[model samples]
Target: MAADITVIIPARNAAATIGAALASLVPDRSLIREILVIDDGSSDRTVAVAVECAQRHGLPMEAVSVRLDSAGAARNVGIERASGASIFFLDADDQVMPGSLSLLRAALERQSGAGLAIGASIRRTKDRPDKLKTPDGYSPDKRQNTRRYLRNELWPIAMGSALVAKWAAAHIRFPEAIHLDEDTCYWTALLARADAVTIEAPVLVYHHDEERMARRFITAPRGTFLAIARELDRLATAGVERDALQWRKAWIAQRIARQLIKHRMFADAAGMMRAVRAHKELGGSPKALQYRARIHIGRLTGIGAGASPTTHPAMPQRTLIICHDPPFPPTSGADLRNFGNAVAAAAFGPVCLASVAPWNGDAQPVDHDIHVTALTTDSQRQAASLGWRRIKGEARIPRPALTRLKTLVRDFRPDTIVVEGVALFKLLGPSRPLVRQLILDMHNVESDLADQLPRKSIWRPRFSGVRDLERRAAAICDRIWVCSTSDRERLRTLLSKPVPIDVVPNGIPRAEGIPTVLPQPAVSDGFPVILLVGHLGYEPNIDAAERLARTILPRIRARLPAAKLVLAGRSPKPPVRALAGLDGVGLVDSPDDVRPLLASAHLCVIPLAMGGGTRIKILEAMAWGIPVIASPLAVEGLDLTADEEVLLADSDEGLADMAVGLCSDRARMMRLRARAHDVVWGRFGPRAIRDAVRRGLGRNDAGS
Candidate 1:
C-alpha cells in the first residue's frame, strides 16, 4: 500500500520557476497524497502560476493565498492544512527528484521509531555542474543520536529533502520570527523528539542563486539578528545543552556583526551586540565575553553612537601594527617576521599590536613593552567560503576582527600604521584621517604564490583575484616592504605604478647559547632520527609531512633499515595526526620548545614542494649547527649556497640518498653545518634585519 505524503511548498514571488517544480513531482503523484502551495503576499503572479501548474497536472493539489511576513508563517499554515501521514517540505523554486517521495516513505515505514527521513540534496547553478552538499555528520548506515546529531550538524538540513511524520509535525512549529536560519531552528526542534534516518541519495535539486541570496542578506533589517537570538534562547530553554548551542549562536552573531561593519553600521552593530549579550544562553561564554569587550572598546573609542576619537597631544609618535594572526610563539616564518618587525618598530615609537587570534586561543600577555590587543572571533572559519569576495578586491572586512581593529585605530590614533601581509591591507580604507602614513609589509607576492600552487587547489582560481588587491595596496600605501629582493621585483612588475619597495629579509634571533644536549647516535637497536619542524596546521607543512611519512620515509627506511622520522610541530591537523601512528614516525604536537627536538636530530629535513617564503626552519637548523637537507622551493629567495650551506633535493630518491649519506658522514655533516651557520649570521642576521626595518620605516636611529 502507498503511504500518505503531503508536499508543502511555501513561496513568495516564485512565478519564474514554479512550473518546473510542479512538473517534476508528476511521476510520484500516487505517493504524494496532497500538494499544497501557500503563497505569502507575492506581488507577482506566483499564486496564478502555482494554481495553473496544479490544474495542468490534474493532481490533488490546492493553492492558498495568505498575508504573512515570513516563509516560516506560510509553512505553519500549510502544516495546519496538511492531511497526509508524512509531511515533506519543498521550495517552489526547487524540484524534487523522480521517485524521491516513495523512497522517503518506504524508509519511514521500515523504522517504527524514526519520525524523520532525510535525503541528500544537490546544489546546481546555471554554469556549474551539480554538487552534493550533504548534511554534516550524516551517515546512511548509522542511526542518528539526537543530541549528538544536533551538536555536530550546526547547518540547516535542507527542508526540501526531508519527510517528517505527522506525529512529529504536530509537536513542532516553524519559527516565524526569524528571517534567517529559521529552517535550522525549526528542524532542530522537530528532530529533538524524533529519531532520524538519512538516505544517501540526492532527492532534490536546489537552485543556487548567489547574487540574489547575497543581496537578501545585505539588505536584511536589524530585527533579523534579534529574531535569531530569541529563537536560540527558546531552543536552549527547551533543554538542549547551552554549551552545545554556544558556537552556533556566536557564529550567527558574528556574521550579523560582519555585515553591519561592512556597511559602516557601527552604532547598529554595537546595539546588536548588546542585545545578543542579553540572551541567557549566549551571555556568559568566552565568545560572549569577547563580544562584550568589543562593544566596550567600540564605545570607548568613539566607534559607537555619540562618541568622538580622542586625540593624544602629548604623545610624539605612535605606531599601529595590524596582522592577520597574533605574532607569538613565532612558529612559522611569517610569524617570526611579523613579531620581529613589530618589535623593531617599537624602537621608533610606542607600538600597539592589533591582531586576530583564534576563537579558542587563550589571551596572550604583552611583552617588550608592545601593547597587545587581540580580536577573538569565529569569522576566520567563514573565510573559506566568502573569503574569495575579499580577494576579488571587494571593500569588505570580517566583522569579528574588523570591529576590534577599528576601535584600536581610533583609540591609538597612530601616526604610522604598518599593515602586515596583503591579506589585511583592505582594512586601510580611503576615509580614515587618523592614519598619517600607511606602510604595506608584503610577506610574499601572494598572487604569485597562488599561481605556484597546484592547479586543483581551491586557492588557484582565487589567486588571480589577489593581484587586484596587491595593485590597490601598492597604489595607496606610502611604502611597500617585501621580504626579499626577488619579491620586490615581482611586485614592481605586477603594479601599474611604481611604489617605493623596500627589502626587509626575514631574520633569525641571535643565539643565546647552544643546547647542552649533544646530538647522539641511537643505541644499537634504535633508529637514526630525521627531524622535520614546522607549525603542522599549515597546509604546506601538512603536505610535506604526509609526503615524508608516506612516500619518502619508506624509501629512506628501505636504504637504512633503522631510520626514524620525527614530525615536531604545534596544532597538527587530523591528517597530520594520523601520520603519528605510522611505523617509525613520531608526531609531537605543540612542543614547549622545538630546541630539544632539533638538538637530538641526526639531520633536519625540509621537503616542501610548494611555498613562497624562505624557510625559517632551515635557518634555525643552520643556527644550531645541524646539517640541513631541503627542497629548492623551500630555499627560494634565500642567498644560501645549495651544496655548501644546504643539500638541495626535489625528489624522494635524492632526499633519501642525502639523508643516508649525511647521517653516516660525521665530519662532512659538521663542515656543512658550519658553513650554513656562517651564511645565516653573515646575511640574514640581526644587524641586517635592524638596518633594513629602519630604512623601510624611514627612521635613521634604530637602537643597536
Candidate 2:
C-alpha cells in the first residue's frame, strides 16, 4: 500500500542540524509514508546526515539534489516525485515534536474534506523554549473550513507545522519566484479551496540560532517582495476580494520599492513600479504614482543608474514625507492632518508619503495624487526592544524601520524630505546627507503637550526624554511647520537655536452636496442624537468618550430623556467599546464614512480633555454643516469665536449645558452652523491650504 504521508525536508547548508531534525521523525515512521530530503545546492554534508539518520532508524527515505536558491522550488520537486496521499514539509533546522504527526494524521482522518492540518510550534531560543499558543478558544482536533480558520486563528501558516493533502499540494504548489513568505502564500491558496483542521498541541520546534536569527533580520531581496506582490495580484484577479487583498499588495510593493531604492537596484525598482501600475487595486493609488515618479526621477538624476542605457526626461523636484504612522483611512485628527498635508504637498511636485504601519496590518493606498509607502515590521520582540531603548533615553533609529527608510531615501532622491512628526527623527540619521532640504512638520509643540500632562500619567516620564530628542531634531532641520502661530512661538522658545518656522493651518475638503440645514430625524419618532467623531484608539479620544458616556451624557439625558450619543471612528480599544453597554451611548467602530453619522446628529461635540494638534474633527463637522459644541482645547488653533462660530465649553457640566441649548434652539443652531461653515470655507478650505503648503515649500526651497 502507498504510504500515509510523504515528509519533504528541504536542506541547504544545514549539516549541523539536519541529523537532529531527521532523528525526531524516526519515532513516528509508521505514520509517515516516505521521507524525501531535497538537498538544495548544499555545500555542506547535509544529504549524508539526513540519509544516515533515516537509515539508522530503518525508515523509508529518498535523497535528491537540486540547484535552486529557494526552498519553495526544492519542495515543488519533492512533491512531483512523492507517491503519498498527504505531504508534510519539515525544514532541516527544525525538529518534529513528539506526538505531532499522530495528532495531525488523526485529525486529518476525521475530517475528509480538510486539505491542510496545522499545529502549534515551540520556538526554541538558545537559553529557553517558548510554546507558540494556538488561537484563543480553539478546540483541539476540531475541523474548520478555510474561511472560518483564516478569519479566527492567529496561528502562523509555516511549512514546518502544516500537513497538506497530496491532491491539494499538487494543485497549489509553492511559489517558485519568491523566497520570502512563500509558505504563507501557498497555504493561503490551499486554504481558499479546502477545509483545514487544527491540533492544539505543539508539533514542531523551530530552532532560532544566532545565524538564522541574523538572516531573518536581514533586508529581504527586491525579487522576494516582488514575487509576493505578483502572487497577491494573481490571487486578486482569480476572484478574491480586491478590497481585502489591496492592503497586502500595497505592503509588498512598498517594501519592494524601499529595498530596491536602498540597494540602488533601479532596474528592479522600475519593474516593480510598472507591476504596481498594472495591478487592479494598486494601479490607481497614490503609492503607484509615487513609485512611477521615483523611477522617472532616478533615471533623470542617475541616482541608482547601474550602467543602464535607458534615458528619461527630467521631472520636477520630489519631496518625501516620512511619518511614524500610516495616514490612511484618516480616522484620527493627526492622521487626517497628515493626509491633508501630504495631498497638498503633491501639488507642489511629486510627493511620496513613507510611513510605518501603526499595527501589524497591511499597508493601504491613499489618494491617487500623493504616493504612499508603508514599512511594516511584524516583530513584537523588535517593538519591545525599541520601547525599552526609548525608556533608556536612546533615540536612535531601530534597525527594522531604518532599513526600509534608508532604501527609500537612496532610491527616490527627493529634493526635500519632510519628516511628519519629531518622533520619527531617527529615520533622518542615514538620509540627512542625501536630502537637499529637511522640513520638520510639527503638528503641535509636542513638548508642550507632554509638559501639560499630569505627573501621574503613564507617558509623563517619557515626555521629558522625547522633548530632549525633539529639541535636538529641531536644531538640525532646515525649516519647521506648525499648525498655529501659537505652536510656532512655543517651538521657537523650546528650541535653543533659530530656525525658519511656517504656519500651515489645518483644512478640510469641501463637502459634496451641501446641506442647507442640519439633518434632522426623517420622522418625528427619531431620537435627538449627539455625535462624537474621532479615532477611539487615540488616548485623548478614548478619555473623551469615557467622560462623555459617564459624566456629560447623563446630564444631557436628564434634560432630554430621549437624547442619544453616537461614538464613531476606527479601531476602538476594549475600554472604548465597553462604553457601548452604557445607557444612551452607541459605538460605531470602523464606520465606512463618518459623514452619514455627522448628518444625522442634531449637534457634534468635541469634549477633549487633553491632546495636541488642531482638531480636524471640528473642521470636518463644520464642513458638513453640522453645528459644533467643542471644548476650549479643541478650538485652540482654529480662528473661531465662542457662541458665534462654535459653542465652546470647558467643564463637563458646561458642555452638557451647551449641547442641551443647541439641540433645543433651532434658530441658534442654524446660525452657529452657517457661521462655522463660512469660517472654514474662507480660512481652512482645501484650495487655500494647498496654496499655503506650496508657498511654504517655495520659501524653504529658495532659502535652502
The number of the candidate with the highest lDDT is 1
Model 1 segments more than 4 A misplaced: 1-317, 357-367, 375-389, 393-396, 400-403, 430-432, 509-527, 702-704
| RMSD of each predicted structure | 26.6, 24.0
By summed lDDT, which 10 consecutive residues of candidate 2 come out lowest? 306-315
RMSD of 1: 26.6
Summarize candidate 2's per-residue lDDT along 208-236 as a digit string, tens digits. Answer: 66433222212233334545667766654
lDDT of 1 by residue, 557-617 (tens): 8878888889987788999999999989998888877777766777777788876433877
lDDT of each: 0.70, 0.69
Worst 10 residues of 1 by lDDT: 306-315
